[model samples]
Target chain A: MKGKIRSMAYAARHDGLHAIRPPLMKRIADASAPYLYSAPALILIVAVMLVPLVLGVSYAFRDIQLLNPFSGAFVGLDHFRALSEDQAFFRALRNTLWWTGASVLLQFTFGLILALLLDKPFSGRAIAQALVFLPWAVPSFLAGLNWAWLFNPVVGPLPHWLYRLGLMSQPANILSDPQLAMWGPIVANIWWGIPFFAITLLAALQAIPRDLYEAASIDGAGPVQRFLSITLPFLAPTIAITILLRTVWISNFADLIIVMTNGGPADRTQIVASYIFTQAFKRLDFGYASAIALVLLALLLAYSLLIVILRQWLLSKD
Target chain B: MRAKSTFLTIAHRLAILAYIAFALFPLFWLLKVAVTPNDLLYTEGVRLWPSRASFEHFDFVLRHSSFPVFFRNSLIVSGSTAVIVTVLSSLSGYALSRFRFRGKYWLVTLMLLTQMFPLVMLVAPIFKILSPMGLTNSLTGLVIVYTAFNVPFATFLMQSFFDGIPKDLEEAAMIDGATQFVAFRQIILPLTLPGIAATLGFVFTAAWSELLFSLMLISGNEQATFPVGLLSFVSKFSVDFGQMMAAGVLALIPACLFFLFIQRYLVQGLTAGAVKG
Candidate 1:
């Protein structure tokens, strides 16, 4: 790679010297080229995303209301104090754990199975693969609404089917049932997210050398044994990184909950992210919303940091 | 042993079939509800296929509602975002792919940080920032935000594409007296067409599916994207299942089309950057 860059750089200067461009000017241009290429994207990200991020962090320290013009005063620690006493916030924190955990676990488990099944070539594999991966293409809010419809007994089928199967006493909407409400969004999330894991793991699975499996079989290793000793070990890195990234992403995902239940039925499905949205949009409490969002952000960062440390430690052990 | 192997093969096929059914059932249901006649919708409950089906809802959603406007706005916003993002990211991605320059580490980190942080945090502040500049409640604002949000991932994707192409091509061009940028434009860009298509598809679907930001930014029906329009419509008229699903099936068109177009490259494109933040 170093030699490649050097040769490219040498060629660049050679061209510069032959042309009207001075070698000094050529060197400066080459040095600034990457920056120029990246400048537009960088400027947009900073202005639109990063600036707002910093402002949001500051909003956590101030009292900012959407409707009130006089509500932008600096109010240090008040929102945090209210947050500490707020039961809804604590419940949301717990619900976030439940939502993210169940969604990721179920999605990964099903996704891994699907990937393994598809790893082998067969008739109609292309069509089947496309069909099975289709759900990931559904817009998330639509997915949530679709699932909500399924659970609703009015014109949908799931509740009726569940009742007929004796899982429920009668056909009823589970989203209105506090004990079962969170399941609505979690199920939607699992359905929507499974293909992500399946696709990634399938790619990783296909990359594994075919000869290794062939060799394992020739050596009299059973399917289960080969999976344990070969497949599992090979997939460890992708699984770890995928799970870590997915955990953060899922925890911050509130679209399903927001769409399906809107954190209703006594707030059973209200994860922290959804709670933040409610504060920001419903109550128009920008300051309080920013405070909650800050906490969620901190929690996600801590979780990511912990995973990084764990990964580093594991690497060191090896 | 032969029987056991045969049984395993059958089991695998069965498992795949089950997955296909599970993945497609809800979308099928969406279509089913959309087509079921309103009278049959309530009278004949829980049937896989209603006794009578109609395109009445589709007709209504298309001809007699605000959906056409929402559809146009979404296409405009998503298409513009996809095109703009693809262009910017190609340039940035090529730089990242070929050049080793100062502050590259920080640039990569900044992009990574944008991906990690909860964008829901930006709701209030982004609203505040855009409102002052009269960018709020406009499709242009949405295009700008979506473009910025997607650039990082698209850049990484484009970088992977550039990485796959041989560096020799560009070097040869430079040796022939073309500057690096010219070589990149004339030689490298044409080779990455599939990559460009994949990036465009990826960004289009993302922008198409964006919910909260558009919901926060666009309040009026005039500028509302499909998600915002459909969501607000669902909330206001919760009882209109047939019409809602019809609108939904309509919204699914561009995304599903893009999905089909890019399915071939999905794994290759994502696997390269999926590991990073």
Candidate 2:
């Protein structure tokens, strides 16, 4: 009877007699047709993203001085060699590393902790979550302004208050201090980063089935034990993806640095982004700036490729 | 089951309260300073509140400054960029999320590639290009540059949202005597209100506070966005803390209002693909 009914349904599907028909061939087409329809977006993305990227790569190799305007001379490794001799380039590179390294690690740490804390059910979690996410909503440039003032020494409220509370030796201009300025952006970044990390990890946390936790508990597993055994393993992939994305973002940041220090205190806070800005706009050294930009791009590209590899590795482990 | 769990729950709540306080302290301080009287600003030092409060600074900034001009310019730039980007990205994102054709993989790869580069790197070339077009020192140029820079990321954002929606609704509408564009407009567009709101808010706030391009492109205060205009408060000798902070406080208003207006969408967007809840 089951076979007879199946055969009749199959016949109806093949004949297209029914108003709604589900079949293997139709399902394949349905899945594929959307991809086919996405052609225009694909084209535009290529035009907008690909062409410029490739153009940038080619431009990086040439001696594209602004003085010449229209035509650029092809100079092979000369630009790279020139960059090696440049002290400001080295400072920027070092600063870029520091920015990416510190910001990415802290962002992950804070995001993870917040996500874990917020994962469990609690009263007022909704409001807490919204408040935590608020910083990410504000523009990054505005965030820099807010933090810059907060770190101000005399007229600024923070140092003034700190001194009043007997929390400091004296009024410290955190922004003007070379040692503190880099961290100024880092602090602002971490503040902005908390929400992104919290949201992503929280999603991963919620995906873990209650049954798994219950079973672990029944087996006499402690909270830490259960989390280590099940939660961490399940969350590894999401964490990896999140970190990769954030790393690329943190490295490419230009606004915060610009607004906060302008790579100042004698270029101590200059990251690759700020460095490029100075070289291109401030110094009018377009060729050298392009080279720096290329190098920055290369570093990020490596990270992007690593993300792909990590994703594949994740799938294989699963 | 009752007493021990209740005790633990209270501890958990306390911990969350601490975190919330930490997160909100800056914004609370912003409001606190905005309300604090100018004479009390330095005199009150680090105190959370002043012995006295007034609306004088807000009044002055509103009634007696170039702030209104900056505010109007910002609104125009941000609004135009958001609307233009959303429209462009809507079409492009639709194509990306719903279609398949030649070079699709490459196209996506290219978009991803664009995102990989530091945008500061492109500023020079962009300036060089825009300079000749006579776009510099103009709000239109700022809007165009922002639109260009924001399009790729916004397209990706819109695409993700489009992907969440089932294509069946549009197909169904098409089958029921609607053209593809009509189906997209009437059926699919309504469903994407949340996504549209997210894109608009994101682009608006982005262009609103953008300083680097505005500074590079516009040389004068006449066309300055608020972020650039804020820098004008600084001079060769000293920074005007009162005026700068007041302007900062005023700048916070539109952004706050913007988010407030679109908070519903932002909330929805945060949870879009996360979990069933």
Best by lDDT: 1
Q: Report the lDDT tens digits of candidate 1 across residue range B53-98.
A: 8999999999999999999999999999999999999999998999
Off by over 4 Å in 1: A1-21, A305-318, B275-277
TM-score of each: 0.94, 0.85
Q: Which regions in candidate 2 have their CA more than 4 angstroms from the true location?
A: A1-78, A160-168, A308-318, B1-7, B235-238, B261-277
TM-score of 2: 0.85
- Tell me the interface RMSD of every candidate, in Å: 1.7, 4.2
C-alpha lDDT (0 to 100) for residue A102 of candidate 2: 92
Q: What digit string (tens of lDDT, one per residue) describes model 2 on residues A1-318?
A: 999999999988767845545575576665665454554445544544445456666667787766666658888888899888989878888888899899888888878888888988867777787777777666666688777878886455677666678976788977788777788888888887777777778888988998999999999999899989999998987887777766777777778888888898888899888888877767776777788888877777777777656655764786
Model 1, C-alpha of B177: deviation from truth (Å): 0.7
**lDDT minimum window of 10 residues, candidate 2 chain A:** A40-49
Interface RMSD of 2: 4.2
TM-score of chain A of 2: 0.82
Evaluated with TM-score, which candidate comes out highest? 1
Q: State the TM-score for model 1.
A: 0.94
Query: What lDDT tens digits, residue by residue, belong to model 1 across residues A196-268?
Result: 9999999989989999999999999988999999999999988987898888888889888888999989999
